[model samples]
Target: MRYVIAVAETGGFTRAAERCHVVQSALSHQIARLEKDLGTRLFDRTSRSVRLTAAGEAFVPVARQAVEAADRARAEVEAATGVVRGRLAVGAISTVAAVDLADVLGRFRAGYPEVRISLRMGMSEELIEGVRQGALDVAFIGLVPGTRPKGVRVRKMAHGELVAVVAPEHPLAGTEQTDLRRLAEESFVDFPTGSAARRQRDAAFEAAGLTAEAPFEITSVESLAKLVRANLGIGMVPEAVAGELRGLHVLRVRNAPTREELLVWNSLGPSPAAAAFLSGLGIDPSERSQRSGRSERSERSA
Candidate 1:
């Protein structure tokens, strides 16, 4: 169609060939083959120039329209198939995966059976970097205040209340809720010093005029929970994770800090499969609007 249109518009074989960046003979052959296929002469040949016949004139507009429509339809199909059948790489913090991500992914897989989903677990900072570098399509991370990386979008997926956890036999375990001062006295099983969780914990202690002195530092939440279960120390953890401790008692904090569980992704945009998977997990763009409204309401009330 392009070749035909060029020839019609140029009104000469040599000019059409020049416009199409093809040799004149090749253009002539292509037009000849096209005419043969249609069983009609598409051009009237004269020694000086070429002109469209009545049949050619009638067919040119319809041919161009058909070609344009076919091209658009092909593009749309490719975009849709890209969404339906591709790999979506995702990352999550270990605790989030244990608490709720597996179920979300399970539902996503059931809906998009053709999409291959790969989930990696890592620290929140690492996951954020992964999404920023295009290594991950999206991630579930512990939210950090004032730490948004450039070219990445962050959405809060859930809010978790903080809780103090201790071994069942620990003295403070029997309390309904404990004060920060009392909780600070015990040895702590802590996240890495610079971690988002650790930052929040430190800020909370600072606000309450107390300090956490962890004898040991462990990066894994599962390990931190286990250490707490062994009477190693009292640790602050998200309620979702604390609820999973079998032999530990999680005490509510009288005024502990809360953390947002966030979904982070590159600003470059999502593949069709990734977008569909996110939608299936109920984390569509509208969910972000709803969360923002709730946060605003909470702030106004506070």
Candidate 2:
């Protein structure tokens, strides 16, 4: 029943397998066996599409109620017994999580001591996908600003700007502010393509109508700063990181485009432990009003 629900919720077998943490063949076999026992087909599959058959449409609601009722019963029993024990999967970008995660985790541990917290770190795009597929209970990510996945919910945490970092002896290091386009031809150390950090860098350059010559691509903000300090190339990094990396000069750029940090989750059917974890963050999972700010530009993925 849970596997069927996952398949229905995610819209495809492959995604359902990922969410359930099972091999596709195993999930298919189990679901097929389930259908055989029920003596009716549950899904109609084709090369490009999958949907419920007429009998499936009639059966799914009952199956969903059974799954949801069992979950609620388990949550209620845990609450009544004062034993909060379930796994909570959380994902985040390394840099963003550094802001207040230690503190959040500390408080969360105190509140739900029996809850097993699993922390996974990755790029924002992948993190968002994790939330969409129900692999992660919640995530902290950087986004440009726009529509999110159908069932996932989003709340803005911060809307902010990043500054340029250069070697201490570099010309722009001593300057209070620099024109963004002036360094178009300079060697640059930047985030690799398809990463949220890279997207921000690319968007800023495109907004200014200047081509970036970032031949040195990287993923870690720390690594990017190290390269800048070595005088290999200048890089753009968050203000928090700019303040910390040794021998690096931080320069404010004129009208630098901003990025947003967001908390993404699916509140409707989150794991019991995950829901408790959200409460510890001062987030009422069901409250959309928890979202704070909006970027002026179009929205991107979490």
- TM-scores vs. true structure, each candidate: 0.66, 0.69
What are the Cα lDDT values of the candidates? 0.74, 0.76
Q: For residues 149-268, could you state the per-residue lDDT of candidate 2 as single tens digits? A: 345677777777878888988988778788777777688898777667777777878888987788788767777877888898988776775777787888888867567778888746
The list of candidate 1 runs beyond 4 A from truth reads 1-78, 81-83, 97-99, 145-149, 285-302
Give the lDDT of residue 9 in candidate 2: 85
* Pairs with backbone N, CA or C atoms under 3 Å apart (clashes), candidate 1: 83-273
Q: Which clashing pairs does model 2 show?
A: 145-299, 145-300, 146-299
lDDT at 205 for candidate 2?
83
lDDT of 2 at 196: 72
Pick out the ten consecutive residues of candidate 2 with the lowest summed lDDT: 289-298
Tell me the TM-score of model 1. 0.66
